[model samples]
Target: MNAPNIRPDIRFVWLNVHGGTFHKLIRLHERLRDSGLSCEVLFSVGPPRGLKLGVDVPLERVPELAARGVHFLGRTEVLNRAEKSPARLTVTDAHHDPDLPRLVRGLRARGHITAQMATLLGDFCHHGAEHLLMQHPLTLFFEMDYNHTPEGRGFAQAKTIQFTGNIFFEPTANRLVNDYPDREAFCARYGFDPARPLCLWLPNSCDARSETYGQVIEAVRGAGANLVVKLHPWEYAFKKHGGEHPWGLAATTDVLWSVQAVDETDGTWAYRFCDVAMVRGSATILELPFLEKPCVMLPLKEHVALFRAQANLVRTCCAALSDMRDLPPLLKNGPPAYSPQDYEAGRKSVRIDTTRDAYEQTMDALRQILSAPEELPVFGSLAPLRRMADPFVDASLIRTLTPSRRLRYLAARALRGICG
Candidate 1:
């Protein structure tokens, strides 16, 4: 695809590997422009084959971004143009992009600054090949908070890591407060009872057959609260591809009360209206405290083990359900109250900088990097040398594989002592 005609002296090239990252980048770009940073910005979306299910940025949004003086490009086109383009910096979210490490290295080699910003808390959790990117000496890493895990601390002390605030917080909060000012009107539009406590359930993409999902719905009903469910975008994509419906039997069958299933666009608004939230492996766990809403974590056994550090931190501050039966009483009694004091405490624990909003912090970081000497110095040691032979597999590859193929892949990796 031909690149859109814009200023050739692009100061920032933002690459988005996921739809969520794309939207967050848009927010940051808007802020930078509004703040009178006249530097040209180019937005690039990952190719369809490169992205996982449900994370592709919709093409309809491209024209709108273009109308705002942002040039949009395909992943391949951006990579090709980067070789000779006069862009001063290239920025991307710390998503599971298999090409990130190599791309960062290439850009840095060409005397351009490279940055990877964390859009979610999970971004701090380095797993498998991500360590390669995190440990790179030249690339700058921006995180939502001061990571508490051992791995996170090690990377922070070794690499060029900066503590930026949550990029989604201000935008989401402002939208909820300004766009949907009245909770009653918002509830009425959705046909939800404003009288009952509203519980928003944000499920992971792979939670199609989860038994806990049904239990949560029943628990909300038992507590006499209205339920709003927003499935991961991937779940909707899966359903379109003849996969199991996210609601399973509930999708076809009728229930006693309303189960309003909303799209991704309604997520932030729902967070504002809901009294409490039910989450499993969603970033909403970290975000809810900032909104002053307590969340109930319904962690699957595998997820807890995989994300042990995050699980421990969340379970420490929020209410986590070990037994499904306990959900009703907690919902009825209302989960532990999360106050401004609690938010401050949690902020300190995570080491998030709240003196200014995320957008301003990000802009400041960019200015600092841009004004730095062109000859950037290496900061970290030669640790990336040890993981040279690590089998670099895209996480999406594993997610898209058939059961048999997945088992075979795991077996192959196990033979090489890479699979845990």
Candidate 2:
């Protein structure tokens, strides 16, 4: 089979070999290739293998990625050819995946230009400042809007962060305004009636309060509202660890199970028809106003302090039900009048603007990055040497040699102790 005959000027490199994240990048690569660009995807290995996270599992979709004309390379392969490689640009969906910064640092050390396509719309609560501040210089960030969020500011401290809007929401504006799915069909598919109020509840997996999924579903159902529950991908991982919470069950016919189907249609299919939405801390809240749906932030006690900390920003857009019992009362009056100011504020906090075409902006940014001169890789103020050596230490060669999972665990612990 011939290579996709990609243009030499633009080469896309996707990192962090995982489930849906890898697939998302593959679709983007295909979209770019069809537009006459050279693209190859490299998956992360080495230290990622030593880690115990379920997202760190072996690459499962290489055949699919290959069929899309993406060249798949492991981290070791990338390192071996770095001294003589010709791909002037590298693109990734993850900047904070633990193994990624190290590999990115290596690629930059060899003078390859790097860029990150944010997986989320700058959901600030999910990441730490170091995830941004520690990357190499000259790395470009194609975020929604860099000036609005702390992550963007942190990236600005060390890299060229662009306000390209988020590519994830590029199709959102169209969906919300003109291309929304037919309400009757959506209702029938989810066992909901078009005339009845349908509530969509999204819960994150990080909190034990997630176990409240069952309670939340029951509450909404008892309130004379039909429900659609979408569980975070990590929630399944949680159940594997013996978190036999009720939300783990495959939802029944009455409730819509829209997990991982966001890309199957226009991403906002769930939000398009729902009368009201509920969220704990998921980024899906960012889409509520655009879809003209009112959202209520369920007051999960555990996340109350976080809400209080960012209350000014969060409450501006949605009603915060101080108690779960208030669900009926809040929805009794129908969806609240959405505040344009609140919506814009929420968008800024997450670095999203539905009006802008982020996909085109991102491609333009990549082209511009390719034309620029490479900057020397910068070291952190502290532990420059150790930080420089981190990629190799976490590289696949070291972890692959460990004979067993227990040994790998001990080796990782020992490495941390020594480095500290």
Per lDDT, the best of the predicted structures is 1
lDDT of 1 by residue, 1-420 (tens): 355444332244445433333455567777777777655555564333223222343456446556775555766666666555645666654555555556666766666666656656445432211112221111222121112233333342223445466566543533311256688877877788899998988866434556766788888889998888866644443433434554453342112223557544456678778888887777666666566677777756554543333444444457777777788888888867766776665554343465666777778766666576655444353233212212323343244344675676466546556523
RMSD of 2: 12.3
Q: Estimate each model's TM-score.
A: 0.69, 0.60
Candidate 2 residue-wise lDDT, 93-183, digit = tens: 5434454556466766765666665545433211221222111111121121211234433432333434455555432422211244487
Question: Which segments of candidate 2 are over 4 A away from where they belong?
Answer: 1-36, 40-86, 95-98, 121-159, 171-181, 206-211, 236-267, 290-292, 309-311, 339-342, 352-355, 375-420
TM-score of 2: 0.60
Q: What's model 1's lDDT at 408? A: 60
Clashing pairs in 2: 46-396, 144-165
Which candidate leads the pack in TM-score? 1
Q: Give me the displacement of residue 315 in model 2, in angstroms.
A: 3.7
